[model samples]
Target: MAQLGIIGHKGRMGQALQQAIADAGHAIAGGVDAGDDAAQLADNCDVLIDFSAPAALEGNLHAAVGAGVPLVIGTTGLTQAHHTAIDNAARVVPILQTGNTSLGVTLLAHLVREAATRLGPDWDIEIVEMHHRMKVDAPSGTAILLGEAAAEGRGIELAAHRESGRDGHTGAREKGAIGFAALRGGTVAGDHSVIFAGNEERITLSHLAENRMIFANGAVKAAAWLIGKQPGRYTMAQVLGL
Candidate 1:
C-alpha cells in the first residue's frame, strides 16, 4: 500500500480522498492545508493528490518535484501560465492534471469525441454545466474537458472555436462554433450536458455526479496508477485505460 499525501487536506474533496485512500487499501501519510508545507508531506508520502485552488498549484508542483513524488492535480480554473508551469514540472515528476476525475466522465469524453467526428459542422455544438454554488469557477472544468474532446474529434483546436458566453446583440450562432453555458445554485455536486443540434434531429450526451466521492475515488485510482510512471504529464483517459 502506498502512502498518499493530500494538499488542501481540510477541504471537501480532501476529506473524500481520505476515505477513498482507505477504501483502496492505502494509507494517508499526512495532509497539508493552505499555509502548510507541501515539501514536508511529499517527503513522507509516495504520491500527492491536490484538490486545492488554482493559486496553490505552483507551490504544490514545486514541493512534489523537490521530493520526487508523483502528483495528481484536480484543481480547476487554471490559466495558460499555470499550464506552462505544469508542463515544465512534469519533466521532473509524473503529474496528472484533469478537470473532473470521474471514470464515467472520462468515458463520456470518449463518446463525445466519436459523435463529434461522425457529425458535420452543420450540427451545432453546445455545452452546459451546473455546479454547487460554492464552486468558484465558471463553465466548470468538466465543460472545458468535454469541449476539448468535441474539438479534437472535429480535428480542430478548442482555442479557435470556443464560444464561452454570448451577450446582448450577439448575432446568430456561428457555424462550426462550440458554445458553453454555466449555471450555479443550490448544492448540486455537478451536472454536464453536451448537445449536438442538426436540422431536424438533435443528439445529447451527459453525466451527472451524485456526490464528491466519484471524483475522490477516481483521483485515488489515478494516484495509485501514477506511482511508477516516468516523469511526464498524464491524462485520466490514460489512467482509465481508454
Candidate 2:
C-alpha cells in the first residue's frame, strides 16, 4: 500500500480524499495547508495528491520533485505556463495532472474523441459544464478535458479552436471552433455535456458527478498506481487502464 500526502488538508476535496484513502487501504503520511511546507510532507510520503488551488501548484510540484515522489494534481483553471512548469517538473518525478479524474469522465473523453474523429469537423463541437456555486472556475476542468479530446480527434490544438465567449452582435458560429458555456449555482458536484451539432441532427455525450467521492476515489487510485512509476506525466486514462 502507498503512503499518501495531501497538499490541501483542510479543504472539501481534501476531506473526501482522506475518506478515500481509508477505503483504499492506504495510509496517510501527513498533509500540508496553505502556510505549511509541502516539501516536508513529500519527504514522508510515497506519493502526493494535490487538489489545491492554482496558486499553490508551483510550490507543490517543486516539493514533489525535491522529494523524488510521484504527484497527482487535480486542481483546475491552470494556464499554459502552469502546464509548462508541470511538464518540466515531471522530468524529475512521475506526475498526473488532470482537470477531472473520475472514471466515467475518463471514459467519456475517450468516446468523445472517437466520435469527433469519425464525425468530422462539420459536426461543430460545443462543450457545456455546470458546477457547485462555490466553484471559482468557469467552463469547469472537465469541459476543457472533453474539448481537448474533441480537438485531438480533429488533429488540431484546442487553444487554436476555442470559442469561449459569444455575446451581443456575435455574428455566426465559426466553422471549426469549439464553443464552451458554463453554469454555476446549486450544490451540483459536477456536470459536463459535449454537443456535436450538424445539419438537422445533434449528438450529445455527458457525464454527471453525483458526489465528491468519485473524484476522491479516482485520485486515491491514481496515487496508488503512480507509486514506482517512471518520471513522466500520467493521466486518469492510464490509471483506469482505458
Candidate 3:
C-alpha cells in the first residue's frame, strides 16, 4: 500500500482525504494542517496529495519535488504563474492536477466537448456551476476546463469566447459565446451543467457530486498511477483514459 502525505490536513477536503485513504487500506505517513509546514510531512511519505489553496500550492509542490515524491494536486484557482511552476516541477517528478476529480465530471466534460463539436456554432453554450459556501473561487476551475473543451471543439480559444457574469445593459448573446454562472450555497458538494441552446430545443449535460470522497478516491487513484510514471504533467482525463 502507498504511504501518502496530505497537505491542508485541517480543511474539510483534507480530512476527507485522510479518512478515504485509511478506508482504502492506505497509510498516512504524515500531514500538515493550516499552520503546519507541509515540507516536513513530504519528507517522510512515499507520495503527496495536495488539496490546499492557491496560496499554498507552490510550497506544497516544491516540498514534494524536494522530497522526491510524486504528487497528485486537486487544488483549484491556480494562476498562469502557478501553471508555469507546475510545468517546470514536472520535469523533476510526476504530477497530476485536476479541477474536479470525480470520474463522472471528467466524463461529462468529454461528452460536452463532443456535443459542442456535433452541434456546431448554431447552438450557444452556457455553463452553470455551484459549490459549497466555503469555496473561494468564482467561475471555478472545473467551469474553465469545461469551457476549454467547448472552445476546442469549435476550433477557437476560450479567452476569446468566455462571457462571465452578465451586468446591466448587456447586449444580445454573441454567436459562439460560452457563458458562465456561479452560485455559492450552504454545504453543497458540487454541481455543474453545460447548456446547449438551439432554435428548437435545449440540451443540458450535468453532474452532481454527492460526496467529497469521490474526489479523494480519484486523488488516491492518481497517486497510485503516478508511482512509476515518467516525469510529466498529467490530468484526470489521462488518469481515466479518456
Candidate 4:
C-alpha cells in the first residue's frame, strides 16, 4: 500500500483526505499544516498530496524534491509564478497538479474540449461556477480549468480571449471569447457549467460536486497512481487515461 502524506492537515480538504486515504486502504505517512515542517512529512511518505495555500507551494515542492517522491497538488488560485515553480520542480520529481480532482470534472473538461473543437468560432463559450461562501478565489479554479480546455480546442490562448465580471456598458460580447461567472453561497460543495451558444441552439455541459470527499478520493487515487512515475508534470487527464 502507498504511504500518503497530507500537506494541509488542518484544512477541510485535508481532513477529508484523511478519511479518503483510510477508505482507499492506504497508509497515512503523516500530515503537516501551516508552519509545520513539510520536509519531515515528505520524507516518510511514498507520495504527497497538497491542498494548502499558494504561499506554501514553493516550500512543498522543495520538500517533495528532497524526499524524491511524487506529489499531487490540488491547491487552486495559483498564479503564473506558481505554475512556473511547479514546472521547475516537476523536472526533479513527478507532480500531478489540477484545479479539480474529481474524475467527473476531468471527463467533463475532455468533453468540453471536444465540443469546442467541433463547434465553429461563431458559438460563444461561457463557463459558470459556484462554490462555498468561504472560498477566496473568484471564477473557481475548475472554471478556469474548463476555460483552458475550451481554449485549447479552439487553438487560442485563454489569457488573451477570456472575459469575466461584466458590468456597466460592457458593450457586446466578443466573438470567440470565453466568458466566466462565479457564484458563492450556502455551503455549496461546487458546481460548474459550460455553455456553448450558437445561432439557433445551445449546449450546456455541467458537473456538480456534492461533497469534498469526491475530491479527496480522487486525490488519493491520483497520489497512488503517481508513485514511482518518472519525474515530470502530469494532469488528472493522465490519471484517468483520457
Whole-model lDDT per candidate = 0.95, 0.93, 0.89, 0.95
Q: Output the number of the lDDT-best candidate.
A: 4
lDDT of 1: 0.95
lDDT by residue for model 1 over 24-125, one digit each (tens)?
999999999988879999999999999998888989999999999999999999999999999999999999999989999999999999999999788999
Which is the better candidate, 2 or 4, if ranked by TM-score?
4
**Residue-wise lDDT of candidate 4 within 1-242, one digit each (tens)?**
99999999789999999999999999999999999889989999999999999999999999999999999999999999999999999999999999999999999999999999999698999999999899999989899999999999999999999999998999899988999999999999999999999989999999999999999999999999998899999999999999
lDDT of 3 at 8: 81
Can you give the lDDT of residue 112 in candidate 1?
95
Across residues 123-190, which tens digit of lDDT does each residue of candidate 3 receive? 99999999999888989988998999899988899998999999899989899899999999998889
Off by over 4 Å in 2: none
**Backbone N/Cα/C clashes per model:** 0, 0, 0, 0
What is candidate 2's lDDT per residue for 1-242, written digit by digit as tens?
Answer: 88999989789999999999999999999988897889999999999999988999999999999999999999999999999999999999999999998989999999999999999988999899899999998888899999999999999999888998688998988899999999999999999999999999999999989999999999999899998899999999988787
lDDT measured at residue 192 in model 2 versus the true structure, 0 to 100: 93
Q: In what order do the candidates fall by lDDT, top score first? A: 4, 1, 2, 3
After superposition of all CA atoms, the RMSD between model 2 and the true structure is 0.8
